[model samples]
Target: MPNAAPEIRTFLCRSDNIGVLIRDPGTGACAAIDVPEAAPVLATLEAEGWRLTDILVTHRHADHIEGIPEVVERTGARVTAPEKARAAVPGAARYIGEGDRVTVGGLEATVWETPGHCADHITYHFGEARIVFSGDTLFTLGCGRVMEAEPATLWRSLVRFLDLPGETAVYSGHDYVLSNARFALAAEPENAALQARAAEAERLAQEGRFLIPSTIGTEKATNPFLRAGEPALARAVDLPEGTDPAQVFTALRAWKNRF
Candidate 1:
C-alpha cells in the first residue's frame, strides 16, 4: 500500500516568511521546514500535539536560521542543512547535499541542490506525497531573485521542477502571490489563466488566506517565470520570436526586479 500523505500545517512568521510543519500520523514524527521564528513554531507544535523530530533548513538566510538555536534547544530536533552553508548554519546536525534522503519518521524527502536565491539553497521533495518545499528558490507566481548566480543558473533550477507531476504541490518559502500576480499579468497580459489567477490571489488576500502549495500545473500555466518559453511572454519582454528561453527568462527576471 502507498504511504499515506503526511499532515501539513502552514502559517506565517516574521511578516512574510512561511512556517511549515509536516507530520507522519503513524509515528507522530514531525518536522519544521524552516525556523523563521521560534514562538509560532513552538505554539503550533503544542497546539497540534506533534513532537518535532527534525528541522529542515532550506538555506542560510538570517531570517531562515535565526530561530534555529531556540527551536532546537527546546525540542531537541535534529537539524539537516545544506552542505554549502555549513559555516552559516552551525546548528546543523547533518549537512546534506543533492540526492541525500531525510526521514521524519517514515516520511522521506530527497534533497535537490537548487541554488539561485543563494548558493546554499536546497529544495526538499517528498516524492510519494507529491510535495515540494521550495525554499527561496521558487515562489507561487515568481521565482527567487538571482542573487549569487547568473539568471540561467536559476532558470535551470526552475526548469527542474517542470519534470515533476503537475499535481505536485509546491510549498514556497514566502508569500508574494499578490505582487507576483501583478507582475505575471504585466509579463503576459493576454493570458487568461494568469488573469484568473491574479483575481483569485486578490480574493485570497482579502480573506486573510495565503496562496500557497500552488500546484506545478498552476505555475506552469500562470507563472511568467515558468512561461518564458511561450511566445506571448517572449513578446511581452520585447524579445523576438525564437529567442533562447534562458534569455527571455533573464529579461523577465530583470523586469521583475524593477517591478
Candidate 2:
C-alpha cells in the first residue's frame, strides 16, 4: 500500500463521463487518463498549478479519446494507448500492452489488457499507489457491457480486477453508479449491503456528486456482478445453487442490458 495518496482530481465531462487528473506531488509529473474534453482538464491543471506530462488512453472510444489532440497540443504530454486501438489516438507516442509499465515522475503503472468493453481495452494499475484506472472494464457496483467479447471473456476480465488488493481504489471511465445501484438492487434486494449502497448512491445522485473511486472490497460486498459466484446472488438471480459463475454473470449482464 502507498504511504501517501497521489493528488487526484475528478470532474464530469460530456455530461455523464468522468475526467481525471493524476499528479505525482513529489516530482510534479501529472497525467490525464482518457481526455473526455480538454477545457475543463486544462482549467483544472491551471488551478492546481501542475504540468501535464502524460496522457494515458484506456481504449478507442470517441468520448474517451476525443480531447486528446487539443490536450496534447496545449501540454505536449506524451501519449500512450493500446496497440490494437492506436488508430483512434493518432500520433500516440507509445503503444502499450499487458505487463508494460509506464513511468511518470518515477511512479510506475503496470498495464493490464482487459478487453471486453472493446477488443483492445486496457486498464492501468498503480500498485504502489493502490489505484487502478479501470477504464470501462470495471465500475462502481457494475462492470462494462460486453460489447466486443464473449460474456465469459468479460467475466474473466472482471476476475482480474477482483484479484486486486482489497484496498485498491478504482477509478472508472464513466459515472454510471446510480443506474447500476438500481439494477443491483433489483437483482438482489435481499442483500443488506446492496440496499445500503443504493440509498447512498441515490443521495449522491440527488446532490449531483461524483460516485467513483470505490474500493475493491466495497464492490465485492455490494456489487451483484462481482458476487455472481456467491450462493446468495445465485439464488437471488433464480439460478440453482452452484451454477457456473460465468452463466450467472451472462444472465445478469443480459438482464441489465434490457433494464
- Taking all chains together, each candidate's TM-score versus the true structure is 0.99, 0.97
Error of 1 at 181 (Å): 0.5
Per-residue lDDT of candidate 2, residues 151-237 (tens digit): 999899899888889999999999999999989988888889888888888898889896788999999999888999998778876
| lDDT of candidates 1 onward, in order | 0.93, 0.90
Give per-model CA RMSD. Answer: 0.7, 1.4
Hey, what RMSD does candidate 2 come out at?
1.4
- lDDT tens digits, residues 111-214, model 1? 99998899999999999999999988889999999999999999999999999999999999999999999899888888998899899989999999999989
